[model samples]
Target: MSDSKHSGKHDREMLLEMMHSTTKTSAEDLLISYKGILYPSVLCCLETFQALETFEAREDDILVVTYPKSGTNWLVQILYEMVSIVHNKEPLLDTTMIEFGSPEILARFKDRPSPRIISTHLQFKNIPKSMFEKKVKILLVLRNPKDTAISFYNFHNSLPPLPSYNSWNLFFKDFISGKVCYGPYFEFVAAWDNHFNDKTMMAITFEEMKVDFPTALKKISEFCQLPLNEEQIDLVARCTSFNSMKEQSENTHGKLGDSFFRKGEIGDWKNCFTEDQSKVVDEMFEKYLAGTKLGKMLNYAKYCKW
Candidate 1:
């Protein structure tokens, strides 16, 4: 085998060994290193990661990309509802999240019908290259890092496959240090900011969607060329409201339950972030995201600040 192939094989073996050896007492223990990025061992594996390099993205596919806890499922529900309205059919949520399954599970999506909605928490750099080459439309979601961190902390503790933190303090340290699965929140936002102006991508913030659902839904419709009449948009808005989704969580998420829905509030971080922790997040934003388009889009001063 070629040296590169041999190296890839060795890396997979080492990662599997590491994953099996750990008791998963901490975030570091439950994550596997793939191409220098950390991924939850339960959600990602080497085969799926490698297959993504050559994964064929349909031209009409809509890829919803977000960092964890950045309103991904919310957007997915809205998108599904929008398309269902356009087609005059009942909406069925497609949770064919690209990065969360094995190679075989990923392969199963190959034959899925047109206009597939693929979701991922993977950073922009890690997404399938064919997506860009095929010019697949991407809806990128951004959330204030403070809220993202808070929701992510709750998510980790609630999800059994993930390592649970004893307190927000420990999760906050891991979150800020880029030690959590999928790496640093700041870097993930910055990496996608590089492609924000790309013709195939549209970026939106979670706070915007929360404040004005109809306007946000309209923007998404225009970007994806999926027309939604005002009536239909209203229906989607009502169905996707955090409370509505939370009430239907067991039906929507099955055993995953309401943990996936959580609070979905814009500034719930205030309840969890200590004064010093908030300051650290502010400093990190300045250091990594300040003055960037994504930062401006996030409107940090309005949503993230006191």
Candidate 2:
């Protein structure tokens, strides 16, 4: 082999060696908190989360995306029901959690038909620029971080056959450490909002969806360029209802059945947090989002029911 080729091979090996030697953060070790923001250390494995938008989407395709526990299931069911009513297709009923996100765009979803509807939790940095540049139809859902945490606490704590986190203190630590799916939640949201433009992205809040179901549904249908008459809206509503999601959580999602829908109600954070816990979250938020839009979005003026 040529000396230059040998040198190139050696450099590549060295880079891989350094990465292996590096003490990478584990999923359980990230502790990002502050102003309802999480900014834990991250590995770039998330960079592999992209697939072609047009490659996976047809001219008629659409997507619903969110951080975990941020009403992802609800949106999925809503969109599925909407599509079902509009096209009279069988409910895109698949019972695996893997189908929950943009995995549907990858080889894993090679079998899904055209005019596909997909989901994903990936931040823009993790995905291909090509996809976003395509300006595909996107429905991004944001939840109040405070409520997101409470929901996450309930969902993970209730898991069967997993290590039971018996104390709120320990779980909070894990949250601060960025040990959960969609960890550093604030960072993920900020990245999405900042990197992507508004036209292709229609960002909604969980609070809005809960407060105004019909309005949220109309906004989404319009974003996807599919208008539904009043009767059709009712059909979509019935299908994405909380009870409906809870009933088929395990059936429609990847795994972990009914557990997926434990208490979809908001402000449940009050059920567990003490005055002291509130202080902890406040401290972290102060450090992470002190003067940014996130800090402003956090709005100390905005009261959390906790």
Candidate 3:
């Protein structure tokens, strides 16, 4: 075989080896390693990974990117409502996240009309290259790592396909080590830091949204160019509130249920993270995110400090 073909064969072999190894441990079985990043095997398949390489992004597409449990669903709901206002109709929400489905499932999106809002938990490096080339508008949602970790732990336990930990301590070890799906929280934040200044991207924190929903909604409307009037914005705010979403969870999330709307608070991590665990996350933050522009945007001292 030619050199390029030989390398492709080797990479496939490595992926298969990693998948097989997952069967040996409960923690390992929860995620599959692909190109050095872990993804929930239950939701991602080999075909999905291959399809992402060639996924087409349109110029008008609005991509909502976030690490897992970083308020992705909440942001999507807000965006959907904004779109509904502009079109004067409440379109049924498309919650099939980009990287979580098969290539065949992803192919279905091509038929959807323009101004599509696509959501994904994929890391920066894994996003389709076509997105950058097309200059698609990206809205990145960030959460303080401590709260993110705690939310992630609860999510895993509640979802049947995801692995459940016997205790938070066991999950904490995997999380801090970057062994969870989508890899380390610190690295995920740092990777996106490179694009903080991009004209096509807007970075918003979950804490910021919780503190001021209307202001955040206005920012999103401006970023999306949807230009909702103040009255429309207020209506969307009331409809998408945490309680409203939680009550509608059965219809919105289907089998996933209300776990998607649990708590939605900023500092729930305090109840779950031990003193040492908190320090570990703090040091990791210091090492990877302390001086970066994204870190500043997160307001680490205010939101992440214990």
Ranking by lDDT: 3, 1, 2
* Candidate 3 structure quality by residue, lDDT tens digits, 56-112: 999999999999999988899899888888977775575567876456567767987
Quote the lDDT for 233 in model 3. 91
Q: Rate the local accuracy (lDDT) of all candidates.
A: 0.82, 0.59, 0.82
Clashing pairs in model 3, backbone N/Cα/C closer than 3 A:
none
lDDT of 1 by residue, 1-306 (tens): 112332433332323333334455655656789978887776677888898888999999999999989998899988888888887777756455687656765675787776788889888888898998899999999999999999999988877557889988998999999988889999999898877756889999899998987999999999998998888788989988889989987766655656688788889999988899989999999988899988899999998887
- Per-candidate clashes come to 0, 16, 0
Off by over 4 Å in 2: 1-59, 95-105, 160-163, 250-255, 283-306
Off by over 4 Å in 3: 1-25
Q: What's the alpha carbon RMSD for model 1?
A: 6.5
TM-score of each model, in listed order: 0.89, 0.72, 0.90
TM-score of predicted structure 3: 0.90
lDDT of 2 by residue, 1-306 (tens): 012333443322322223233443443443333234332222222212323332444445566677778887788778777777777787654422222222331444546665566666655554434446556777778776667777777765554322336677787777767656556766776676565566777777777778788888998888877679988887788778788777766444334455677877767776778888777766766666556554454444353534
Model 2 alpha-carbon miss at residue 154, Å: 2.4
